[model samples]
Target: MRTKQIANRFREVILDGLWIANTNYKDQLSNITWEQATTRVESLNTIALLTFHINYYIEGVLNVLKGGALEIRDKYSFDAPKITSEEDWKILLNSLLDNAEEFASLIDTMPDEQLDNYFVDEKYGTYQRNIEAMIEHSYYHLGQITLIKKMLSNE
Candidate 1:
């Protein structure tokens, strides 16, 4: 009984993260290109990069939580899509949405104990911390996506 309750709560957080990913930002982040998105006022991070960053870590945490191996990539930490056509941007946004759902499926099956397990030297945090932190991480980029959209609209 208690396990189901805890699982439901964690499921809610994961669903919230997915909701943050799939919204439209006044046409700013949803369906735009890096070339179309770049601006002197905007850092190269752009909406596309932000989408990729959020999804990358999301996939990382989800895969790791489900006992899959992790991969390394050079994203928002060092550099990002400085030049991309509109088509590329749409592809990325779609991928993020698709993976967001995949992560949701992963969460749907999480055992309560798995949520508390410690995987040494594996992910950004212990399993519980990873799940908790994903909420903040996804929302942080969602906020960036929202702000960039606003900046683009204003320009």
Candidate 2:
């Protein structure tokens, strides 16, 4: 597949699960209240923290795609802002969606040669690998969010 085609496919599955069986972030995370978002289940990260952590890579890579240096630190990925109200949660979710859209657009414009080249440094792997990894990462956390929601609902 071409570069744009690959990027488009990634975006569809990552953002909305367009052609995938699992629920996307939009569907899974929508309608979440502050209570649900901030509730902790055992030792697992709260849904709010998981949500931000999932988007952290997207925001970092999006910056790199826009010619900025990456500034992500794994230790801080889960440090989402405190959800004091519904508006706070809404703002965070909106930012996540906005960044995802920008990242998708940037990927679509990337040269095919870039996809084959190493992303940032050779130790990190190729652009294609890193991009796909982000998709996998999001889905992984989205699953956690889904299960957490279900667990909370059952309580």
**lDDT for model 2, on a 0 to 1 scale?**
0.82
**lDDT of each candidate versus the true structure:** 0.58, 0.82
Question: What is the clash count for each candidate, in the order shown?
Answer: 0, 0
lDDT winner among the candidates?
2
**Can you write out model 1's per-residue Cα lDDT over 34-71, one digit (the tens) per residue?**
66455535344666666667767777766775677766
Residues 56-109 of candidate 2 have per-residue lDDT tens digits of: 888898888898887998888877878989998898888888888888888888
TM-score of 2: 0.92
How many residue pairs of model 2 clash at the backbone? 0
Residue pairs that clash (backbone atoms under 3 angstroms), model 2? none
In model 2, where is the ten-residue run with the lowest total lDDT? Answer: 13-22
Q: Which stretches of candidate 2 lie over 4 Å from their true place?
A: none
